[model samples]
Target: MTRSPLVLLGKIWLALILVFLYAPILVMAAMSFNASPFYQLPFQFSTDWYAKMAGNQQIITAAIRSVLIACGTTVIATCLGTAASVALFRYEFRGKRILQVLLFPPIAIPWLITGTAMLVFFFAIGIGRGTPAVVIGHVALALPYVIVTVSARLSSFDVTLEEAARSMGANAWTVLSRVTLPWIAPGIVAGALFAFAVSFDQFVVSYFLSEPGDSTLPVLIYTAIRKGFTPEINAISTIIVTVSMAVMFLAARFSKFGGSR
Candidate 1:
């Protein structure tokens, strides 16, 4: 059998790109298992770092905080974004396009800028910095992703289903719950997963919005790194990366991200 040169080149390029993107993460994950606290040569395996990470009160607290914030963000963002997506899908009105366009800034703009703006705005409004502020910022950041994901799934929805349900005396709520929601359930799940991942992995916004004494995992990791790099940091980072990857994998599976709808 013969293969085209271009196809081979493209495969080779993709391989290189994957290596470049994931090599550091793979190295870090491997190093987490290494016994060397300073990450020296021989690479003796040990689970001491994981055990230490489990015991560290600071890390445990930060991890719990991050999980709670992520869950809260997922719920809020998914609800709000799903409602917005349904409205955008079902109705037309003045400023609708403007509203849709507005979803981009949180996504298109860098988190650094968004985080700084949120910090300033919250301070002016007296919210200051805390878990509450971080949750708000995470929801805002996650909303666009949920909206976009749900809207994509909504694109394939049949409008007649709602009309048919309504003709059968189904109220708005009934139709929404019975007809519309089922069709878009996968999207909702995917969007929620995405929201969780966004909030869980979020650093810049959490860093800016969180209090010094109560920081999220990402912020805590940043603080730890400032002091020094240790196997404990690597272990925690590996856990974060693993969770993020799992979340994204579920999202993609539910959303059919790369496949035909």
Candidate 2:
């Protein structure tokens, strides 16, 4: 079949759009390896920063803490969000729409505002500042992601399969566990992975919610950058970018769930 000129033009436009979007990220990745003492354009490449980052105990510890907190947030958000999605999608209830809107306040409000609000709220409730508060804030933001992803998957599902399981002497729990969940497993995993990523990169919430001892990796990076230009920051950025990419790649690869095309 002959390709239309307009379609060719559209493809070219899209390619250009992608280049525009990713060009900055590519530049940052390149600069991370610059050998110059100062962070400037057109520099030599070196691995000193990477080596240094490997030995920096503070950076390493903060990174580990961030990972742990993000994982905890992911588990909590995914469970609660999945449950909410299941109930909202599969059953009828009063004020369901209102609850859905309420769930989105985290994403709807600006991060600075949300962080401040949480900080004050936690203080009022005597929740204290640190990992526990940070986890709560992250969970609030991440749960919306879970709800959106799982609900999208549920919308495409055939509800009667669940009923069929029930007809075959399966209990509600069995039907949910064995039938409905398997179908939406990909979305659940995708949502949880997304939640983890969001929580991992969170700066505002982490900064606000965490006390002195509970600084997250992003917070450490921010403080380091504030001090002065350093190649170590570049190394940290590279490591973070790599980890985020690996996570997204894995999530995309596994989210297909062996389902029909």
> Which predicted model would earn the best lDDT?
1
Question: How many residue pairs collide in each prediction?
Answer: 0, 0
Candidate 1 lDDT over residue span 1-261, tens digit each: 469998899899999999999999999999999999888989899999999999999999999999999999999999999999999999989999999999999999999999999999999999999999999999999999999999999999999999999999999999999999999999999999999999999999999999997999999999999998689999999999999999999999999799764
Model 1 ranges with Cα > 4 A deviation: none
lDDT of 2 by residue, 21-92 (tens): 888777777877887757675788888888888898988899999999999999999999999999989988
Q: Clashes in model 2: which pairs?
A: none
lDDT of model 2, residue 94? 92
lDDT of each: 0.96, 0.88
Give, for candidate 1, the lowest lDDT window spanning 10 residues.
252-261
Stretch of 10 with least lDDT, candidate 2:
250-259
In model 2, the Cα lDDT at residue 224 comes to: 84
Q: Using alpha carbons, what is the TM-score of model 2? A: 0.89
